[model samples]
Target chain A: MEGIYHDADLKDSPVSEKKTVVDSPDIAQTSDFSNLPINLQLDSEEKIRLYSQMVRIRRFEERSLRAYQQGHIGGFLHLYIGQEAVAVGSVSVMSEDDHVITAYRDHGHALAVGMDMDECMAELFGKRTGCSKGKGGSMHFFAPDKNFWGGHGIVGGQTPLGLGIAYALKHRKKKGACMCFMGDGATNQGPFYESLNLASLWGLPVVYIIENNGYSMGTAESRHSAGEPLARRGEAFDINWSVHQGHDLYEVRDAINNALVLAKESSSPSVLEIVTYRYRGHSVADPDQTYRSKEEIEEYKQNKDPINLFRDKLISEGVLSDEKANLLDQAAKDEAEASAEFAIASPFPEVSELMDDVYWETDNPDQKVSSGEMFFESSR
Target chain B: MPEITYREALNQALSEEISRDPNVVLMGEEVAQFKGSYKVSEGLLEKFGPDKIIDTPISEAAFSGLAVGAAMMGMRPVVEFMFWSFCYVAFDQIFNNAASIRYMSGGLINVPIVFRGPANGGTNVGATHSHTPENFAANTPGLKVICPSTPADAKGMMKAAIRDNDPVCVMENTILYNLKGEVPEEEDFIIPLGKARTVCQGNDLSIIAHGRSVMVALQVAETLQEKHGVSVEVLDLRSIRPLDLDAILDTVRKTNRVLLVEENKPFCGVDSQIAYLIQEHAFDHLDAPVKRVSAIDVPQAYSKALENFQIPNHDRVLAKAMELL
Candidate 1:
């Protein structure tokens, strides 16, 4: 807990014997969103829908954990179990053409963006039919049709790419905003702040969504973030920004929807700070229960479980029967299982494919045939 | 033809490119109002306005990425990094996004983007601002790296790069910006990317160079031919990445000797690549090993004397060429 504060300043990274720690016991509870005005906007059906989506993400993640353990998937896997509402609420309002680019934790966003469960599961299994043509594993999922750009691996790497997508959208006279999702840990990167300043100055249509899920992997936000409030960074750049409870799906949806509308109308960039939590460790491999305590996880689950709270609202308003909720959960499970099976049966890419997509084929006689397809076809 | 400085030629090229293509736009810090830091973007904001001539915050990563994205969405964006040293921050965007996007998108995306900037040791900018990054860009695939030494070449290449589908890195030497030369009057004339220019002709030995080294090699060639009684062929390798291997091979085949000059570091430098290329293609014609005149393997120092020693110069080119001959 004492080291969590120290861990924030990477200049002094704590040398723990264990490489990955799960929990941050000293993570300060900063806000009680239930009392905020943003909380009052959630109606029963909306709440239940949000809760159902969160549950879907959670259940899907649990199944994925088992699959990974059973050797069904390979490469790095980042789960969005604790940070479900960030995706569910923010993505709920985006149009088909609006862009969403994020770092590795992308399953929830993929689902939120309407990528078929089977396809997503297949992609994770490295099937050719998957979104990235089996080239990208779990951390590289992309659905261009859904305007979901990537599962960028590097921390704060997508910040500039997101800005570019927005610039492109604006340049082409497309009235869609780019929602760039990064973690609180990524904010430590100099590019994160630099991107904010540039995005705001250009009046680019971008929504920088910092899903402050406490840890930047194992390092807690309290330890990593400098004295400056992460959300208020937008104000320094004269960019419009607001901090809200990320666990409250209604709050997140309203904030993102409002931000998108403002960006569309004004052609300006905005920042939305979603104070959320991630229940699972940074990756599938880390237990994450070490840095933080069980009591804290139980506390958030008991007090601020977005899915449970929404389910209760739905039941109280008679919007859904317990039977319907259980059925949807079962359906999601079956979909994940079937996709995994399909992916398992699928074959890996052939050796010939290794040389494809390297260059654009323009006719340059000097170019060697061995260079493959990616070359300028200049007829000189 | 009009005699103008390299910087003026660059400015003229910008005006011509923007006027020629409605999609061509310029972005960089101090590109608007204040003209340009080096005045290469002077009078562009007034002509193109803020939308087309954007002055970005000092977020190289963000704007560079933005330029790549804009290029992907059917726009030709010309971005300026004030100094070549500052380009390190945006290498990811340049190498990963701008350069790799077309290939990554399965050729669905075309990054017709130009990253233009001043580079090389000059005016005591110290180690940070004095790197010649042609070799780095050349090392990256899917990028067209050009370092033109003449005003005419700068104008022609800048225009070509603005229109080229692949990402092009146009490295302008900071010290050469003020150097004057005759540029052709034709506004539409464009020297294609990946092509080299033979600056001078000879039969005794060939001098392969680019950017500032092109000027140095030309001076060295004139001195060697006139004063030292050596017939020197000077080849200005205008583009570094898609090297002009044909010219290099033919010249080396005729002369049977070569001196590769560059202002970058000796290790993995552009000069080494030229030497390697010549050896690979025209080894049978080579009468002697290709000699290299390059900056010493050390960072650029603040002291002018040390900095000069760090970069290959005219004397060094002449001396290296004489030894090879």
Candidate 2:
């Protein structure tokens, strides 16, 4: 009876203050790179590099969209058109030991981690020369050698995996962290909460980055989520939580850098919500007009485009000129076009190679350890 | 060779593997401090330390997925599910991430993780906790499923599962944990996956079974020999995914009359697949249609009497074998 709850003791009130905005207004207002924190500050050359990387992602996504329209590319293309800074900026702050894994919208992360444009495009074309050898199209890209774990297709599924990577690092006594990126909608998933509890309880070096791009597919965040500031859910698990605007590459770099430092130094996990916008529909197959309006899409494009914002910032700081900017943009466009050509020229995977990568034992015949029939169907 | 319980044999395998490889870690609910729910991981936490033998929160999805991530990074993690029925909560991680990560990455990544726990019904734990998922696990192409019926096979197959490069699901039985059998003490001793063991040789009929049902089939074999004067062969399928088709075909060719047995349900059960393979490959060799003795096709009941009739037992299997004779 002592442990039992009664209606008389229950009081109905709001869980927390309804603070909708997670982004820091101060960081958004700061324009001068010199005034930024020393850890957050970037050199002129590095700034230009980040700008160039964002441009490259935008152009590559645009090209892939074109291919999808032309019927050359099949399946869903979750283009990272508007949220380039989230990938480029976060990846730039990572040490060589650090790793990354993300949800379906993963092309931007793949390119940011230095995956070749040709292979990425070929993968979109479902060619053998692709990153996953045409086995994993659009949604799945992997470069383990580069510490980029995968382009996992399932929503909120990669959260525990990211935690595991960090768990492994700690288990092996390695100094690094894993940044697990997911959409705003992924917060509602059961595994994400479970991951949060474990990450905080074990003090694992993992940063769960929620890219709050205002919409979860067609549903707005206000409709899909109940409480304000999704990252605050980390507080329940005793994890450090914060939010910042993703449009500013500097802010994105700073917030992510701080979280990464907490992971490496303290072996603690943090949840940082990066408030951003996506111009394209959830996938190309999704018609943008269903849940959102044209004016909302145009508004984000004009005011908060990550690529244009960074390019203009670089130009304003005298780190890049108008002519140099145009040249870089043209170069990105050319590179994307050449990647499409490479994908076109690349051959599809041979039918013989269909079962090649299914198992390690099957791949290496001499070291083949398991007995009996591995595959149900025979290629011969 | 020392005779040991199925639980002790599994413990030996985990201990030997943990001592051999630094990357191997034992993690699950109550696995460390509690020494596992079934005491299969007894003395592991003390021998291997907290880092190697970890106790996780009752979050199967997180821990299962965490093991997968660690395996991707070259760490061999052996995760125990308190009960294999609990694995349904982490189905996405076990089925999608663990099973397909290797192939999806074009073989760039290998999930060298092992999920081991008892997956048996008839304890009257009700329908929720009583689920034999070996069939479901084997259905996935990227996964390897093994059901060890004896202490020796359990030890050898568990060691094999830990060392395997792909995700392996070891389906153990709670009732079989206390069963004693001779187990090899050698640290390097391992039975390769996907190989069938001929428990007994006969001329009349073959009773093909795996896991707990294999024990039932063996009992039926004994009764058939002494009571009915019928020669019954018992074949134990240790691994389900890389199924021993050659051994299956050979036994069917020898005995001529085949009777498949399993603890799984009749529909899409491991026996169903075996029955299909027999009819497909050795249909003409069969004296009669390959009959199956599987768990009754319904949700497992909680009542002792009904549950007894539900799971395949010695009497049910003996009756089926007599029909084949």
Candidate 3:
């Protein structure tokens, strides 16, 4: 051992070659949650909260799907059905002040961030009472007061904006990180790479989460990306990259908690890849059978349903009885039903609203006059 | 009032804004330790330090999109693209993210950011490098395209654009960076966005232009007034998006004729909008047909002779004004 001072000097020796460096999974599953550490342990209240949040998202998405099918919701309706564990688990770890932005599949993220279900439904219905005041449809939900930036429509569009928000938080000395969510499909985009590069270089406080739900709409990841894991893309940026089981709430929350700690404490960014499955068609219009099989869908619902897994975990751990879990699911359904009613009752925006909100306030005197005369603003 | 170049005026505006608001930061390629691509940010990095003055990598998408996000969180960022042509890479950020974010958010947040750089053609930077994209931005709703012609207006508009609640695009002309004019020494002096200024008064014909072409229009007006006794009126469009249609219409009414001098191509240009507006609003007032002097419908050539032919010039403006008269 003492003679092996340098690899250069032992170039011709029989035992000269360097030890083989092997790649292993960065995040290991502590699936045996019975022996969970104290700091990483989930309390009964926290578990209840996570279960309730996931259920709410699940119920809202199911209602939204019905609305889309019944022709109440317009435009594209991308449901976050089987991927509830990802949003609930990841967003539950975020501080109230921490910003969250995501791609078009935003119903789950919006509900997790405390956006009103009725307003979100109204937005889906293209009514004035919607989250975005009906200006943005199903794909865009914005709640800045709750630190939810938006649900961007373009693929991979929010990645750079996520970096910008982190920069602001750091610059403003705000004690929070931004949780930016994108799909597995977005990993291949230029904005994602560009944003990751800058976020890594600038030490931005961002938790970049790519929820790999197996497909981008109908195209499977294997065909699109040669079966490469999305987190592997973060390797080039030298960020703290990790992959976790998306179907497991415990693992997702724990991994996201670690990322949040890294970002908030020291302005470090972490790119996390979560393996999940989407239970719905990409949008309401998609037939969804072309890219995958019906058996696969039925199998996921039976075995890997996040809501079922978490409910069973709670029941098994004696945190809550089966009776209580059913109550929570019922409550979530009631709220979703109320949202549907409100969406129907909400009125469409008036014609005058078209000219409104284009600018903050048209400050110039020129806006006061018509083509005819020098009319004052009060008259106009 | 001190006379300064457009570059220095911009530098002063940025310097004063960063000093005034700690949240205001400047980021772009070669904008910090390297002064600036055009030296407009000279001495800013040394004065405010790296936290306020940032030199970004050549990833326009990242920096531009980051500025939009920063603006959302109440950080006013002034992102400089080395050239408007380079902004082609970040158009998604500019058009989709920055422009659409506010309306999408129900106007819950304000993107008080300024995306600025040299945007016009001259000095033989061929087709890819040359663009007068004010119309492209103005066509979209959420963006305010400010094209300042003089050093004073550059200073005023730079400050105002930084302070505006919406994302304002400051389209600086490359040819006019060295041109000197009187800039106000007042710290808070600002020319609000969407206000057009009449540089010269006349009753014969109104020659309207923006950016560096305004200088050409001024020259043409002076030549017409001095040599031809044409009484040419010059209207400088300070901001293109929220176009001051009243000012243009008033000038057209007074002059009874108009000659639009645009440095952009003839088709679907800023001039096209103004031409349609005049015909729509001031048709009765117009005695003769409204004429336009625009760059030919071709990519800007690198050759000097071709570049001169492509962009609208004083001679072209004079010819257009004569034709309108």
Candidate 4:
């Protein structure tokens, strides 16, 4: 296949050959996110809710992997196994008006943004109840009402889209911001740089959040990204920059909250490089722990499981009782199970509905007016 | 009524639209400070200020995508491309993003924007800067392509484009910018998209054309009537997409012959669609096979003489119409 052939050529190659020396390893180790001014003030309930959301995302993916193996789901499925905190924390900080756009690894992001569990599950199942009406599967779960733009398949495709959405918000004088989430791999695309320059030049209200999960599919971040501290690229375009621990949901939430505030109020562009890891293979079809060692996964799980770390913090600080935490975990598991059942029983999209909703009738004089009338003059 | 060049009429229309609607803004390289390379946006920056009349870096894809974003947010954005040839750099943003967003979002988003540029090959801009993309935008489903020859249509269509809900691509020829004509004084008169105008009425054959070709078609219409005693009906397809098939059908039914003229490559040019439509809808009415006069399937040459040879002109159109007759 063309994809495999391209992958083989890029096996040992870096995303870009430009090398720059940076004191990033020291910065990564000494990064005290708790000291950040934007850190969240959370009670027991809020902490548990964030944790539960991450657990739901995890549990959903585990079930989805089984379903894919059982041949219930088809097409490309990029799992969000290890990078739950990034989506949960960032999305948690956003308002109903704030928008989000992301790359292919999107099921977790969709669930985190308050999409109905059954709808997301139905999407993976390719049923009519899916958000995209079974047209876009796991990779394209979109809920525009929720302000989630898409689950884009193309690696760097969503960068320009995110910038555009932010520009729209600014142009309308709306107090809205767009969080454009992309992987470390997409940082190398031309549109990434192009989007950065335009976003900064125009001062578009957008926060570019790069989830540097140390890999593009199977390739390590070290093999990609020119500067280890990807946040520095923001300086070239005069965009405010920050690096946060992706595993620490609190830090991710705090960073996103501040960034959103800055984006919305100042109407300025910024970038946040969240260092994280993914536990599953790039897709369900690929064997896990092959290109990467099991030790690396174990290391991340033991020391940096965002949910576990946050749970321990809540317990030690007397914010959450162990029993209460256990109850929350069980509730999330139950929710995931219910969602799976609902999706399995849901109907596929109707055959007759193939050609509907293709284009708007703008040629009609009635539809062309912008008098703050009804969105569309629908008989229904 | 006023006598002004097609370019001046467009500039005036843009200025008027921006003044009329506070939400209307313009963005392009040299559009604001440099007053636009062709002076189409002259004195705009002084009147509208920098925020509305923006000067962007040499990033067509980025700026075009930004315009798409701006338009989707309910702001009417009129983006200048400097030249239509530069659109290739941002083709993805124009076709995929601006054009597809309304449809893909299930009509939740309306990309009410216009990408105006000097389209068609006539300025001896060479191969790199001399493409007429009527066929490209026409092929895209959700886009509205407008190519106006007269100053009246230029101003009216531009005003309509600014007020349109869907994405519209306005292709203005650089050569025709200085071609003077009478434009209505009223600001509210907007010619709707997809409506063809009878530039000249005759009974023998319809010389169907658009953009720079409209003039050639009219000139050929006169020649055919005078020399060959063949009356020619000319219809200027102002809007390429949602083409006025009724006008073409009416003319074809009367004349029983059609000659499609375009300056783009013959293989997939706008003329091909006109020919196809004539064959499909007006096949029975035709006394002879429908004829097409298109540019040679080669990159536009730099020399004026070479370009003249490649592009379809009045003589070529007249010959083609004669053949059909």
TM-scores for every candidate against the unseen true structure: 0.86, 0.95, 0.93, 0.88
Tens-digit per-residue lDDT, B1-325, candidate 1:
6799999989989999899888899999899988989999999999889888998888788788778766756788999999878889987788877766554444445677899999878577788888888888877777878898888888988887776766889999878889999998797878876677788889898888888888788888889878978888888888876666677778889889888888888898877767766677677998998898888788788898887766777776767776886
DockQ of each: 0.29, 0.79, 0.43, 0.30
When summed lDDT is taken over every stretch of 10 residues in candidate 1 chain B, the lowest stretch is B100-109
lDDT for position A70 in model 1: 73
In model 1, how many backbone clashes occur? Answer: 18
Residue pairs clashing in model 2 are none
Over A8-78, each residue of candidate 1 has an lDDT whose tens digit, in order, gives 11011112221221233322343334344545565656656666677667766766777777777787778
Model 3, docking class: acceptable
* Candidate 1 Cα errors over 4 Å, as ranges: A1-56, A70-72, A168-174, A301-303, A358-380, B102-109, B185-187
Ranking by TM-score: 2, 3, 4, 1
Error of 2 at A48 (Å): 1.0
Q: Please tell me which predicted candidate would have the highest TM-score against the true structure.
A: 2
Candidate 3 to native Cα RMSD, angstroms: 10.7
Clashing pairs in 4: none
Q: B223, model 3: CA deviation in Å?
A: 2.5
Could you give the CAPRI-style class of model 1? acceptable
Residue A335, candidate 4: C-alpha displacement in angstroms? 3.2
Scored by CA lDDT, what does every candidate get? 0.76, 0.89, 0.84, 0.80
